[model samples]
Structures are given as structure tokens and as C-alpha cells.
Target chain A: MDFFQTIIALLESTIRLSVPLIFAALAGLYTERAGVFDIGLEGKMLGAAFAAGAVAAVTGSVFIGLLAAILISVLLSLVHGYASITQRGSQIVSGVAINFIVFGSTVILGEAWFRQGGRTPALSGDARFQTWDLPFADAVKDVPFIGPIYANLLSGHFLLTYLAFALVPISWWVLYRTRFGLRLRAVGENPGAVDTAGISVIWLRYRAVICCGILCGFAGAYLSLAMNAGFVKGMTAGKGYIALAALIFAKWRPVNIMLACLLFGFLDALAIRLQGNPLPLIGQVPVQLMQALPYILTVILLAGFIGKAIPPKAGGIPYVKER
Target chain B: MSNPYAKLPNWAEYGLIPLVNLVVAFLVAGLVVLLVGENPLNAAYHMVNGAFGRGEYIGFTLYYATTFIFTGLSVAVAFHAGLFNIGSEGQAYIGGIGVALACLWLDRTMPWFVVFPLAIIGSAAFGAMWAFLPGWLQAKRGSHIVITTIMFNFIASSLMVYLLTRVMKPLGSMATQTRTFEAGGQLPKLDWLLSIFGLNIGNAPFNVSFLLALLAAFGVWVLIWRTRFGYELRTMGHSPSAARYAGISETRITIIVMMISGGLAGMMALNPIMGEQFRMQLDFVQGAGFVGIAVALMGRSHPAGIIPAAILFGMLYQGGAEIAFEMPAISRDMIVIIQGLVILFAGALENMFRPAISRAFASFGQRSAAVQTKGA
Candidate 1:
């Protein structure tokens, strides 16, 4: 029973850890599906985190912070769109530039405003999204396996966790069931065909990128206002890249993206939990190796050890209309 | 219609456009400095002075530029072959391991000259081997080089931490680093060379690696522009289908280009490990590999252009440090913003001003043509 409890606690930690990754992976899904290869997910999330943390610290309102983050992320997305879509610049170059810009500007602005060590002041009460317990969480705390699963694993999470999971199904439905969904996928596979069919490929791509911006905003907000009380320098710590890896591992499917994120999050939680713990034959595994496991797995996956993962056919190519 | 700018001379296309973009970037950066409550002109003055005012400062700037030159050339070589080698940081990290291993084994018995050459070979071989897997994957499996290279960076960081702390940390030492290399393994500073010209640099870290960087730049110039392999690499980059039709092997070029690029990146280790730190440490690359992208872009992938671009960034880094020391209002992070602005203008938004400039030149050309007709 104690071992089972430990496993449940670990699973709960995995869910908590993967919420931001889920949001970011979904954001990548939208952009990549519409044929824009976005390595700038990291930059957008970092920028949004800084904006959210700064605004929330000032206004003492998490809602206002969320709005600010979304706006800033969308603005950045438009810049990316302008560069790659309108100007026909290299998508990778623009993405890399965005990362450099956001990474630098955030620290500069944060240090200036907070007078702290490139971090925002810690928030409390309404400024942060607090963990909330579900109804009857305490009442069923003493019951058997199912009860503890509900109370301990499923209950008492920040509102964003629920929303992140909820977005998985919503995103799946929007991708597969709707008119925009068909057009978006078609655009990614062959923009020429979509153009010939009379759809505005550029407009569709812009819409997809904007949606990506909003999702990335949620991911960033979850990092600063929910998972952490304040924004710390380099706090994302390559999570955006990890999210991208997860997207590729899932082969750009919504349901599989969530699963891939969970797997990565589980590895992250295991790494934290396994520190200083000796295994039967291996003695103590080093923390760095455990931390690096996800990236190693990503490389292996990309190398087609399991199966070949194909990206969108038109990804990283800017659509050019005939003269 | 023909591109008006395309009719311009090669020097004007390569040199003038990048120069204009750099000027615009600095102007934007000056505004950012103003937002941070510092006088932009004063900051600019300090930057220039800090980089080149004194002999020691100039030496320091050159020291920084040496690393950039190596990494910049690495990226430019890969660019010539149509590959984005983002794994230079990782390769450099592994290259440091090779240097450390060589120093550990040979520092006690071997002479400095022999050890230095061997360490160069060791570092280059290690870096090339590290890049081999990604190159192979891209060549054989159709995997994207960018994604694979980025993933390798994380793996390299983890491997370095593991090696430093768990494997290479000497007994009784708590820090996550190797013991210092013995004197025989260390590279000599360039102060002696400067003193030959009756100049003193006051103990700056500038070393023999700067000369190595210069030699490498010349070597790359010959390799990329003057050789048959250079023609093939450029042919592949311009149009792979044409190269394939002409019977050039894509896989061979991809692997070879990556190995050469990785070897160049690996050479960067000599600057930090041999010249300055004399030990293997974490985060030694310090984003020089990423900065190489901007350097290569601004330099137009030419050795002649890259040397100047590398020096420019070196000034920004060295001068930025000086400003952070002298002015409390503008922190070191502000320099990163300036670099980013430069990269944005010179790379992603490179053609933002081209259309307008070309139009103006086009009208001027037409007016000249009409005047010629009237004269006729």
C-alpha cells in the first residue's frame, strides 16, 4: 500500500510537471501543422513569462497578467509571421533571432523593474494562481485506492493543469472535425493545392500562428504564476525545446503529444525523485544522466530507432504565389 | 524585371548592405540604451574606448575575437554545404574533454610543442566524431540536421556535467572541474609577439590561439573558394538536384562538411582551456557557437567578411563588460539585446530595406539611360 501511494504521488508530480509542456507542444502543433516550423516557442514562452510575472506583480491580478502575456506572445508571433510569411525569410533564422531577442530583453527589463536578480518579486493571494482542492477531497481521503487517486492525484491542482488537459481534446476536435482544421492540414501538406483551391494560404497560416501564440502564452503564464510564484532567470530551462521534441516524438498528433509530454514529465519527476537513491545493480544513478534522458530519447526517436517520424511536408518552406 | 541591387558590384552587395544593416541595428540598440536610462552616445563612446583604448584592452578584445572567428568559420563552412550545424556548442564541449584528456596524459612528460599539436588533433578528432552521428543521420536517414543538432546540445551538456563531477573531478576536490593543466600543456601568450614590436599588453589572456584563428581563416578561404571541393559544396548548396544530376554524392558532402565544421568549432577549445582557464570547466563555450550564426550571417559567409564581423562582436562583448562595470544603469544583459538586434537586422530582416533601396537605384539608372538617349 505504501509503494502504491508512492507511485501515485510520483504520477501526480508528473502531471504537475507536464502541464506547461502540454501547452507548449500543442502550440507547436498548431504552427507546424500550418507549415511554419517554430523553434521560437522557447522565446515566446520566455517573453510571455516575463510579461505575466511583471504585470501580475504590479496589478496583483493574475487575469490581467494572463491577458498581457497573450498579447505580447501574439505580437511576437506577428513579427515572426511578417518575417517568414511576408518577407520570405528563413523560418529557422527568424525563430533563432526571436529566441535571442526574448532571452536578452526579459532579463534587462526584469532587472530594471524589480531591482532584484533578474527575477520578479514573489506574489501571493490573488496575484498567483493557488492550488484548489476539489469538492469532497478531504471526505474521501481515507478511502481505498480509488479515493486516494481522486483526492491526491486528481484534486488540488492549479486551474491551468485542468485547462491544459482539457485543451488536448478541444485541440483534437478542432484539428479533425472543423473546416479550419481541414484547411490547416491541407495547407501544411501542400500550400499550392490550397492556393489553387482559392483559400488564402497566408491568412490561414497567420491564424494558426496566432493560435500558437495564445497557447504559448498559457504555457508561460502557467510557469510564472502557477508552477512558480515568480519569474526566475532562465526559468524555462529548455522546456520549450523539450516540448518541441515531444511534438516530433508524437508525430504531430494532439493525443500523442499529451502522452509524449507525460512520458517526458515522468522522466523529469523520476530524475528529481531518484537523486541520491541507490538502485539494486546500478548503485546511484547520476542526476545529470537522468536529466538528459529525455533529450537522448528524442535523438534516438528522430534517428528512427522506433519508427520514422515525418514532419509536415511543407514545413520550413515559405509559400510564394505565382507572379 | 532584373533585380536592381543584383546589378551592383559584389563588394557593394556584400559590404555595403551588411554595413547599413549594422548601422541600423546600432541605432535601434541606442534607443534601447536610452530606455534603460543611459546616454546612448556616452555608452557608444565607452564601448569603443573600452575595446581599443589601451594595449591590454585591445588584447582582451582580440582574445574574445579569436573564439568567435573559430566558431564563425565553423558555421560558414556548413552554410556553404547547405547544413545548419547548431551542434557546435556541444562539439566544443566534447572537444574540451579531448583537450583535458590530452593534457592529463601528456602534460607531465611531453614537451609543450608536441603536446600542443597532439591536443589540437585530439580536440578536432573528438569534435568531428561527435558530429558524425548527426551527419550520418541527415545523410542516410533523412533526419533534419537542425533538430538533431539541437538535441545533441542538451545531451552534450548533460554528458559534460556527468564527466566533470562524477568521472574527472580529482580526489579531495569538491568543484565540478578538472585539475589545472601543467605548464607544458599550456599555450604561450601573445605578449611576447606584441613586445617584439615594442608593445606591452599588460597580462591579457590573448594567446597563440589568435594566430591559429587567422591561419584557419586563410585555410577556410582557400578550401571554400579556390578548390574543386569548394565548387562541389557550393553546387550542392545552390541546387541539390543539379548536383545529384551531375553525379555528386550528397551523403559524402554532408558528412564531410559537418566534420570540417565540427573540427573548426572544436579548435575554439584551445582559446579557453589552453590560453585562459587551463582547466576543463562547465559552460566554457558560453554561447559562442550560437553567436557564430549571427557572425556568419553578417559576414556573408566569406573569410574576409567574417574576420571583421567576429571582431565587431568581440568588441561588443569586451566593451559590454566594461560598461556593466562603469555604468550601473546598463547591465551586461543589455549587450545581449544589442547583439540580438544586430542579428535580427542582418539575418532575418536582412532584405527589409532592399526593395526600397533597389527601387531608388532603379529610377536613378533609368534617368541616366534617358539622359544618354537625349545626348544621342
Candidate 2:
């Protein structure tokens, strides 16, 4: 592909690559806005993927596995909430503990049950997220300037890919239009005020985290079940972290978060495509540099070029009743 | 609602909440071990034995601990300045690449003694540079170091992987590694002692890297306590606004500490690269920089406390591999389980021990009086 085509290809691929991240980033937003820092997004996502993949592989039921994965992940999220939010423990410390517990347990169980080294067996067609082709997608795929791009790019994708995009609008509405949304935001930015106003801090934060956990579960399931068809060791591989970057980059706005995830996803997709690809003068750029793109951009964004975005005032701080 | 009439336990004054947490963790860890069918005491015994039973094992454990010292010091130094450094992994990576490049460039012309120092300094400089960017961002724009540093680590690791795989591919073997360093680039050994025992220190990769690690720890301790800069760092860490009112520049301390922290992280390469490895292979730091967080936390950011913590962690790491090797199917993973448990328990100690200290400090009268007071 020429430079123009590659750029176009990059944009298209970014959207595709960013689907899972969009889910995760928005998931992070919900929790962070509710005054809880969900550092265990990585662990939650990983655990969910393993559950989903394992169930899918065994039962040949993709939806069931995904649901089970979401449920299990929700439980883990609640545990995290209990530790960090309810118990008023250290957020980072609690996150680190949860990650380890999930990581090691997953590997241990994987070995004992699957006889595989920290990976689940891949699913067959019946068990996997079956890709659906949009009608007329192929006919216009090769039409001309925009035809091939749209057809080749946007036509075929897993069902979750569409859901990830749809979630942007849904998240915006849920965060802004609803009573729960106001309470959630109020709890995060000023929990004391919310508490004085007669709202329960723990319950609101708990509800928000549970929502985040469910979203992260879907994102995790999409990762292995949709993309790779199985869960591998360290499968999340810090994607949850990147989702956090996207979350911060978006300034906790659902719409902005979608853009940030897409940007990162684009960088990631470009990097993957660049691997072993012949370049005129660059002698094929190392994909590692490509992989590093999102982080570099994150660093740039976080360093304050972006306009002021205040985090929820009460975020990550445990409320202790000083009677 | 009428509970205000009751006295606050004098012990409850401090963060007594987190103290009880530690005891619960120990119980959890012990129970988990029991479920796995190993006696917790025997497991603890094996842990102790694996780390220090043999001098050579101590050597192995210390070698691992040496790298952690740099990483832990990196974390502690930043924490002292009130910056969370999740980017030590990247800084260490940069330092690794810096050392490799230095060896590649200077080893041919410079003597072993000269080249070795240059490599160490070069690594530190690279590590410092790593912190500089994030520090600049933090100071200039008030960015969050926790998120930024974590992001930097990813970029650094990915870049390293790409560099090794494609750009810096060694001449002979087409592996994801660079060429081995020349002999002169290696750190000078305490070969005299090993020669006295007539043991093959040559066969074993143990060297004077551990001593350097200890010296760095001492230097960091002195730097943190005895210096004006350290005072500022500690002040800022406690409260940035208070430090600001005290005329201490918070930004200056953040930048300085981040740079210093990164440099310390940079020195971590001395343990592996200059010792037995003599080259940067994949996973050169071997996640030690990441584990250093746990080490730093468990040690409560004290240089002296970190020594034991780092060594303890190193023991589990070595023991894990050994068990996995010996048992075949039994699992070396127990070591990681224990390590994770240790971190969890240590964090809980803050909740566990502080209440006792608080109770010991407060009088019963004052505790009871404070309890009855209503509005601020």
C-alpha cells in the first residue's frame, strides 16, 4: 500500500483494534467517576477472559461463557471494592494484590484443569464469536476511492465490535441524563457533600465499580473469545493499563474516551501491520517502536498540554467516619 | 447515634484499621498454604534454607537482591519526594540499553576499570534521563506520575523488544539479543576470596555487584537524611502545600527526585549486565524493577529495612524455580504465591501495628475526652 492507502488502512484498523480498549476505557471511566480508582481493571479483564474462554471451550456456548465470565469478574470487582473503598485500604496496594491473586490462581487452575501451561484450549466455530458479514459489504468493497476502504474495512466484524461503538452514545446518556449518573459523579467529586445530602457513599461507589467490572468483563471476553479464541498467560498484557491511559486522556468523558481508545488502537494496529513490512528507507521499522506509540502519546497528553481536567475530588480516598 | 459518649480506645487513635488487616493477611496466607498441602512452617523453613543455607545460595539470592536494591531505592526515593514511580521498569530498560551501547562503544579503547565505571554512569545517566521527561511533565503540567510512569514502562519495554529483535541483533546468532561484552567491560571481581576457597567462582557468576548494591543503599540513606535536598523531599512528600509554605519548591524536588530515582533504577543493570550475564538479553531486569515496588512498600521506604525485604523476596524467587525444577509437577508457583501473600500481609501491617503505637502514645483521659467532643 502507498502512503495514503496505509494512512487510510491505519485509521480503519485503529477503529477495529480499539474496540476492546473502548470497552475497557469507558469501563474505567464509570468507576473513576464514582470516586474509585479501578487499578484492578487488568486483573478483572484477565479473569473474565479466562472464565469466558474456558467455559466457551468446554460447553461450546460463547454467550454463556461470556456471561459467566462477566459474573465471576463482577465478584472479583466487589472484592476489590470491599478492600479499597469499604475497608479504606490503599488503592494501589489492593490492586497489586488482586492482580497477583487472579494471575496466579488462573495459571494454577489452568494447569490442573486444562493440562495446559496457563492457557485454555481454543474454541471451535460454535464456541467462538462468529464474524458476521454486512450485506452488500463486498459489492461496494472495490468500487473506487472510498469503496474499497469502507467495504474492506467496515464490513466484517464480530458482534461486540458494533457494541463497543454503540456504547459511546449509551455511556454518554447514562452518565449525563440519569439520576444515578448525577449521584455517581457527585459521590466521586465530592463524597462528603453527597453524604451530607443523604446519599450512601459506599453503595454508590459499589454500584459504579460493579458496572465497571461488568464492562471490563465484556472487554476481556472480547479479547480472547473474539480475537484469539483462547486465553493465554498474561493475556491482558497491560491493555487494561492502556485503557486507563485512554480513560485519563479522554478526561473521563465517554465520547472523548472512545476517541482516545481509537487513537491508541490505531497506533497499535499500525504497529502490528508495520511488523516485517518492507519500507523504502526505514528498513522496516521495528514493531516495538510501534507498540510504544500509545504510551508515548499518553505521556504527551498527561504532561498537561490538554486543558485542565480535575479528577473526582473524593476519588481513591477512603471515607472514615470520625465520630 | 449516641455512641459518641463512649471512649475511643487510646489505641484507635492511629491508623489502627490497617493494623488488624496485616494479621488477617498472615492468616489468609497460612491457610492458603495449608490448603495446598504443605506445612506453612516447613515451607517457611525451606524458604529460609533456600535463601541462606549455602553461601552460594546466599550469593544467588544476594545477586537477585542487588538489582532490587536499585529498583526499590528508585521507588523509595520517589516516594520520599511524593512521586509514585511506576516507570522504573522503563528507566531500567533505558539503563540496560545505555550500558549495552556503552560497552559496545567504549570497551575496545578503555581499560576494564575505566569502561566499567563509564558503563555504570552511562546507565545511570540514561535512567535519569528516563525520569527527566516524566518529571518535566509532572513539574511543568502537574501530570500524575502514577499513570505517566506506568505508561512509560510500556513504551520502554516495547522499544527494548523491538531494538533487540531487529536493530541490535547480534552478529553471529540471530537471537533477540546483542553481542556479548568484551572481558574488559566486566566489573572487577572479589576473585581473591573465591580463590582462597579454591572454589570455582569463575564457573559461578557471583561477583562484587552485591557490595556495590549495599554501598548504593548507604549512599541513598545518607542522601535522604543528611542533606537539605532530602529534607525538602521529605517535606514535600508529607504535604506539598506545607513544603510550599516552607519555601521549598515542590516542582524542583519532584524533578530532582524523579531524576535521582531513575538513576538509581538505572544502576540496577550493574547487577546482571556487569556480573555474570555481561549482556542485555530479553527480560534482563527480569521483573525485579516491578517487584521492587513491593520491596519498597514492605520496607516502608527505609533503606535499611529494604535490605532484608529484598533478600527475602530474592529467596522466594530462587526457591520457586528450584522447586518447579525438582518437583516437575508439584509447582514452583508456590513461591510467587508466598511472595504475593507477603506483600499483602505487609501492607496490612500498617493497619495492624499503628493502632498499638497510637494507643501507647495517648492517655486514657484524652482519648475519652476527644470521644465526647461533637462538632469541629
Candidate 3:
């Protein structure tokens, strides 16, 4: 392949890899903005992935599977909200519990239902979301730069990928321009102030968490129904945590989150490409080092070696009403 | 104002609450088992039989418990200082590298006792160093310890993978593991000790590391509850301003506490590397580091609490294996769900039923007082 084609292909792969991260980071953005630290994004995603795959396989309807995924993800989010908000429990502990529960239950349920080593039966046809080719793709195939960009880079992605990208601007507008956004930010900063302002802090936080759940549901569905054929155990891997890191790296902003996710996605793509390949100067780079790069970068970014990351003041604290 | 429940009894406060939570978790787990078309009672019996029905089972239970004790103590120490050190898993992973390096260099020449001590120190030092950066960042750069530690875990996993596959794997070997250590480098098993008592433990991997775990627990008790540093750590956790007022340097305490915690986590390598596997390999730490978090929380960060909690989890692990072996219906993943439930009830929803229980006790006390007044 030529240089431009190679770049386009890399970019395409980067976009594909980052779609889930984008969705998860946005999910985290909504919750964390409302003072709820959600480390269970991974758990919700895993649950949704399994639900989507299993349901889609059984029903032969991808849309219904997507709905199932969203429902399950939303239920888990409500559990987190109830534990952290109503119960006034430790949010981190709640998040960790969710991850553990989802991680284990998915495998158990998968094994019992499918008997396929904790994997759902592979879906075909309507059960899986197929990539769509954009209009005029063949007509523009003869064009130079624009043709490759349109045909290879922009087109042929699953519907969820487009929605993921579209959600970024929507998230930014919702977070920055909407009335609900203002209240959500204020609650995260100081629930006492939000409460005094006559806003229901609990309800606002719950709303944000629900939004987080929906987005995570989309991310999970994309993984199982779009990217892969079926749900496998631990399939979400550490993407949820990586999304958390990306959220922090972006300082909890929506547009910045896109940039962070893309950066991580690029690194992940590079890591995959670098495996078993020899570099010019370093000779054959160890695959482990490449795999470790993203985490190393996250640690560096977190350490403020580049810049400081200040979380919401009341992020982890459970709000209590005063008499 | 005196709280009635607070005045009930120390045992109720410390012991009863945890026990009730554990029972609730198990009940929920039983329901899950029942949903899977298995008899809960039979499953429980199997778990019990698998964990302690014989000497070998008991040995395996203790063997698992030994690792949990180290990692649990690692977390408990950090908890006392108001620090969440989630990198124990990573620290332990890197500590294995230290053990491997030491074994490679000295195992062929040095005596077992000398090599063992050196390997322990090497492991602890490496683990401490792995934690030091995050601790420093949290103290000086205002970074969140949880994020940094979690990131460190991924890094450690990758680092170990590289070391095992590319760097340390013996030449001509296809496996991703270091060469096995000489017999002298391996820790002595507890078979002889059990034999002295006219008992045989079969091929269970329980070793002198269990003794090390006990000693470490006692050491932690002394360090956390008795020493001046312990006072400072508790003060800092309870009230940072008070600790500052008492001339405690937050930065110093953070670094020191993390180093100590990491050291404890690092010592966990002795069980797996020296006692069981006798070689460096990928994922030896498994999820023991994460389990430590559950252990510390359930144990209320007390050594006394952690020991039993560790043993209970150890039973869950060993018994879960046996159950999977005997009953294919109960997959190994089911045990993970049970563990998660325990974590959910005991850690996250710890105080879910506290108010109700306390209220009940308060009502009972009020009625008894009224009866006494009527009698008077």
C-alpha cells in the first residue's frame, strides 16, 4: 500500500478500536460530572455485551438485542446509583462490586445458557450489525485524496460507530448548554449548593447515571453485535478502565474525551501492528512494551508530569441532607 | 447523647454485623445456585467437604489463605493511613521478577536459608519501589492514588509478560516462563512438619509461607496498633488536619505507608514462587491483589478480622474448585459470583441494614427500661 493509503487504513483501524472507548468515556463523563465516580463502566459494558449477544442470537433481532443490552446496563447503573446515593455507601466500593458481579455473572450465565465456554452462540444476518457503505462511494472511488478518505476512512463503519461520533457534539452541547447540565455540574461541585438552590441532587445524579448507562449499553452492543460475532468472557477487557483514564485525561470534558479516546485508540492500533514487527532502530520491539504503552501514558498523564488533573471536589463523597 | 446500639456490646458492633452480612451474602449465593438447578444445601456441604474434609484439603485452604493474608495486610495497612493502594496486585507481580532475578543469580550457589532471606528482601524492595512512584505522585503532584495504582497494575502485567517471554525465558524453550529455580531456592513444604504430628497433607502446596503469613499478621498488628507510626497513620486517616496539627508530615506518611503496604504485597510472592510454582511465570498473582481489597474491607482493616476473612475466601476458592470438579453444573465462574456478592454486601452495602438493626435494638432496650420502671 502507498503512504496515504497506509495512513488512511491506520486511521480507519483507530476509529474502529476507539468507538467503544468513546462511548464508555462519555458514559463516565455524565456520571462523574454529577458527582458520582463510576468505575463500573466496564461492568455495565460487559453485562450489556453478554445480554446483547445472547439475546440477539436467540431472537434473531439485533435491535431487540440492543434494547436488552441497554435495559441490563441501565439496571446495573440504577443499582450503582441506589447503593451510592440512597444507601450513602462508598461509591468506589459500589463500582468495584458491580465490576466483580458483572464479570462473574456473565460467565456463569453464559456457560449455563450456551454451554460454549462462557461464550454466546455466534450471530449472523440480522442478528449482527453489518457495516454500511455510504452513498456515492463507488462514484468517488476514482477521486484522489477525498476518495480514499470517504471510502476507507469515513464509510463502512457499523451504525453504532456513527452514533458514537455524533454523541460527542451532543454530549458537549448537553453538558455545556442545557439547564440540566448546569445543575449536574453544580451538584458535583457542591451538592449542598444544588440542594439549597432547590434542585433535587439525588434525582439529577440519577438522571446522569441513567444517561451513562444508556451510552455504555451502546458501547457494549457495538462490541458484541457489531465488532465481534458473540459475547466472550472478559471481552470488555480493560477498555472501561482505559475509558476512565481517558475521561481523566480529558479533564472530564466531552470533546476532549474524543481526543483522548482517539489517542488511546491510535496507541492500541499501533501496539497491534507492532507485534512481531521489527522497528528501524530498536529492532524487534517487545509486544509487551507496546501493550504497556497506553497504561504508562495514562500514569504519566495522571501524575501531572504534563498537566494537572483536578477532579470534582465532591466526586467520591456521598451527599447527606441537612435538617 | 448515648446511642443505644452503641451501648449494646462490642461483639455486636465488631463481630455480629460482619457475620450477618456474610450470612446474607451466602443466602444470596444459595439462591443463585438454586436458580442453576442445584441444591443449595448439597452445594454448601460439598464446599465444606472440599475445604476441610481431609488433611490435603485443609492444606490447600491454608495455602490459598497465606497469599490472601499478605495481600490483605497490604491493603489494611494502606487503609489505616487513608490511602487506597489498589496496586498490590502489580506490586506483587513485579516482586516476582525480583524473586526470579535473585533465584537466577544465587540459587545454584547459596544455601536455602540465605537465598530465601535475600529473595524476600529483593521482592519487598522491588514492590516498594513500584508503589513509591504512585505514592509520591499522590503526595506531591496531587494525583489520585487509586488511578495511579490501577494504571500501575496494567504496566506490571505487561512488564512481567515481557520479562517472562522475551527477557527471562530460557533459551530453546517455547513457554513464557523463566527457568525453574534450583531445589535449594525453593521453600520447604509443611509436609515434614505435619509428619512430625503423625499427619500427612498429601500433595497440597501448603508450606512454611503459612508461618510467614502468621508472623506478618502479628507484625502488622504491632505496627498498626502499637507503634507511634500507627498512631500517626490512624490520625491522618481520621483527620488530616489533626495529624498536621500533631506535626505529622502527610507526604512522609503517604510515602512510608505505601512502601510498607507494597512490601507486604510483595512478600506474597513467596507463597506462589518459592512455595508452589518454584519459577517465575505470568499471572502468578492472579486476582489475589484485588481479593485483598475485599478481605481488608470485610476484615474492618484489623489483622484479627483479616485472618478469618482470608481463610473464608480461601475456602471459597478451594471449595469452588472442588465443586466445579464434582458438579459440572456449578461452573468455576459461579464461585466468582459468590465472591462478588460477599464484596457487594460486606464492602459496598456494608451499612445497608445497620439502621434497621440498630433501631430494633434501641426499641427493645426502651421496652426493657419501661418494664423496669413499672416494676420499680
User: What does candidate 3's lDDT look like per residue over B301-365, in tens digits?
Assistant: 99999999999989988998888888787877776787777778888788887888788888999
- When 1 and 2 are scored with lDDT, the better candidate is 1
Clashing pairs in 3: none
Each candidate's chain A: what TM-score?
A: 0.98, 0.93, 0.98
- Tens digit of per-residue lDDT, candidate 3, span A1-323: 49787689889999999999999999999999999999899999999999999999999999999999999999999999999988877788788888988998898778877899999999999999999999998889779889989988899999999999999999999988999998998999999999998989999999999999999999999999999998999999999999999999999999999999999999888778777778778798777777777778877878787787789888988888874
Candidate 3 Cα deviation (angstroms), residue A12: 0.7
Clashing pairs in 1: none
Between candidates 2 and 3, name the one with more favorable DockQ: 3
Provide the TM-score for each candidate, comma-separated: 0.98, 0.87, 0.97
Candidate 1 lDDT, B117-221, residue by residue in tens: 888888888888888889999999888999999999999999999998878989899998899989877888899876776767886899998998999999999
Docking class of 3: medium
lDDT of 3 at B20: 88
Q: What does candidate 2's lDDT look like per residue over B1-376, in tens digits?
A: 1222234454453224323544455567557566545566666566577656665665667677778888988999988887878788889988987788888887777777777778788899999998898898889887777777888888788878878876787766777887878876677666565557663343445667677788889998999999988898999888888999999987788888999999999988877887877778888876777678778876678888788778767877765665555444336556545555555555522444444555554566667778779433
Q: Each predicted model: what fraction of the native A–B Cα contacts (within 8 Å) does it retain?
A: 0.60, 0.43, 0.72
DockQ of each two-chain model: 0.64, 0.43, 0.67
